[model samples]
Target: MPTVALHHESIRLHTPLPTAFGEIRERDLLIFELTGADGVTGRGEAAPLTPYDGVPLDVCAEALAVYASILQSYDDDAPGVLMLDACREAADIPVALAAVDLALWDRAGRRAGRPVASLLTDEPLDAVPVNATIGAVDRQSAASAAAAARDAGYSCIKLKVGVGDDAGRVAAVRAAAGPQMLLRLDANGAWDVEQAVRAIEVLSPAGLEFVEEPVHGLQALRAVRERVAARVSMDETAEDMGALIAGGADAVCLKISRCGGIAGLLAQAALVRSGGAEVYVASTFDGPLGIAAGVHVAAALRVQAACGLATLEALDIDVPEALRVRGGMIRVPTGPGLGV
Candidate 1:
């Protein structure tokens, strides 16, 4: 039989992470460790961002405990199968199941002496480009941040909008970044159909790469996309394949915790791609371990667009073995499992 252990930690952010939902000053992470009879261990993390992830911390913790108890009765011969069963049973707790799903993948990779990316796909990418996020700020501050990000070698920058003079902020960022930089915007579902259409129209001249979750529902999303010239990407509204396909957005953002895990993400990605839409891998301000899992997923999918994985800097403390970013790119971990 396999044993599971869970640990909880709260990390204080050096700088308050701002989003359209609110400012986040701290993050709570639940780490899980699964030890097999052979003495080999695997690790996973569950960090739920409230309002955004839908699942509360207390709820995820409870679900994880339930998952662990259920897994103990299963044979240790196939940890992956056990994880799948647990995930199916705890389908309501997607984030908690994601933690176990990743941990089991880690265990399997270690046992096979191959990286998780290798297991997911045969065509592994060397690295994935990351987008530097400019949190909601005033026009001047947004411009300065955009300039700094460009100077730091980040070719892609994601600007948070839907708060205070959004059009002006977009213009300032575009001016600072110039035409060469890939600029994207995330409204975090702060706008209505009218507001989203107006905002997208006003900021369309900035040459945005795409706008994410500008409005709430699938109907509103389609309306905004129809009214605006810029491409639309769905995040908050993309809960399932049906929603993603019906949302009519050009792209859908995939977060491992929200999508169940690597397996779930791959399935969604395939569905979205088959429908002539693109897929982007994003994060929930997770710690290093969770971020590493995202990196492997991005590599396995051979993502061509910039991903939202350059968020480790938002955390005050990171795992020592976290993946490193350079020249706006994060190198894929080559070691067995989720290397970091």
Candidate 2:
């Protein structure tokens, strides 16, 4: 059993965009490499996801460094050894660890000649529904995007909130999307508790499905949830698998980069089901690797809700056909080890 070495890559989106006030040009993906004693190689990628909690590049570089720095002291050939499980649970480090951890799992699945899904979540699901992401744009643009997503077959839609005219913007989208679309909101913890409650109260009438991370951290999250009418979800405050389950969250936005990796995601899925709550595995606007890993988890888990899968389009790539959305749903990959 030779060790698996974790690696990373930095790639620009092949394009750039301004959404909701920020410019995203590139992304950091966690790629894991497993080298067996006989020299066989296997690979998996962690979703280089960004959060409201930390700087994107800094988080990824720090994650890669954990593997690199430890390899200097820990043998490269002996994998999964001599590390405290809770090595760094501060905020975003778990996501970094998750990227490497998932890649290793991908490597293992490939080496075993089994599909990552079968090894973990079974076969491809019929379809994992999609929720279109409406970014930080004005009402007209956001409405156009949401309508486009609906035309693309998406049944649910998510809006990035907490900017100006918070209620007005959400209401515009809801009105344009009509009364049937499953509407979700992510404030990225930008709104204060009072602001969050007011926004949710105003939007709930427009058929808001859920609002994520209206305020920062667990305590504030709890307070908002207690007071607000909207179903409060945990996005930024969820760090580890433990936090994903125990942060007193109603639902968690599971990002592969947050928990550790594919293996770490599996660990979190277990936590989600065990906690008797729902999980919405989202994209950190990551590339294909993290998205694939998340697809596997979404398929395996008892997720009845739509996931944040529409974000994948923001990053350009020819994704696997199995992962492509049709009728607003994407099926999990059934081929061996995240096959392209």
Candidate 3:
């Protein structure tokens, strides 16, 4: 096994990003690094926001400790799947498993002298289109943010609704962004079925691309979907994919940590696509490493819709060179591994 080390860090956000769940002012990350005998190192991050995912930070940290121990028992040349399976058996926590999986993939890509995306698929896109997020709740603030996003060359924008004044805020954003910009909403499962249907009906005049997690659970999602012409997407339901595969949503949002890293995310995306629903990657406000993993996976899959990876700006930390978003698109880091 390669040498393993773990570090904890808290990164402050540029501004408090408000959502239906709560406001996030800081992100806690478990940074994991693996160094091979040859002196090559690969990195991964485990970010657990308890308010969003219900996975406590210490829980994931403890699970990662177990995974590190499991890794030590393996040979330096152990198969990735074999090692990952062992870790999963020991601790079934997705967030911790995500960090281990990413580190392993990063090490493999570095060894093969290829980008992670290229290793995943025969053909991979050089870049993937990304959507800017507008977290402001008031009409003027939301409009100003939307206009700025449009002027910055963002073709798509995701607004946080189900907070308050949903109709007014959406209208202001629409007026500011114009009709051409793709508008999506994330309610964060704030509404019940009837409330979601009513909200979607009122907001659909803005020409929505989709509404994500308008209501919680598969049954509520199906009820809302039945009444709304606007497409409904699943985000929080990723853990309940058994019901998701039955086709209640028009799209499904897959996150790196939630899906247990890149490999598991791809496997889940396959299942989502098999059900005839579109699948796309979204960030859980992760750091550079996690965001880079999302880009690689989206590039390999050639996902058409704009992804939710343009989130680095929300953090106060410096943007890594390879993970920079250009003209509403994130270019796949051509360097070996995550290229950070």
lDDT of 1 by residue, 1-340 (tens): 8899999989987777677799888889999888888887878888898868778899889988888887777666764865577556765677887888888888888888888999988998989899999885788989998998888899999998887788889899999988999999999999999988888888888898999999877888988899888999999888843776674799989988887778878888888898788998999888877888889999999998899998887778754444767889888888888886
Candidate 2 per-residue C-alpha lDDT over 106-193 given as tens digits, one digit per residue, 9 for 90 to 100: 6566667776777764444645777887765678877787778777877898888866666767878877777788998887877777
lDDT for predicted candidate 3 compared with the true structure? 0.91
Cα error, candidate 2, residue 162 (Å): 0.8
CA lDDT, every prediction?
0.85, 0.68, 0.91
Which parts of model 1 have CA positions greater than 4 angstroms off?
A: 319-322
TM-score, structure 3 vs. true: 0.99
Give per-residue CA lDDT, model 3, range 207-275, as digits (tens): 999999999889888888989999999999767748559788999999999989999999999999999
Off by over 4 Å in 3: none
Instruction: Give the local distance difference test score of model 2.
Output: 0.68
Query: Could you tell me every candidate's TM-score relative to the true structure?
Result: 0.96, 0.83, 0.99
User: lDDT order of candidates, best first?
Assistant: 3, 1, 2
Most TM-score-accurate candidate: 3
Instruction: Report residue 229 deviation for candidate 1 (angstroms).
Output: 0.8
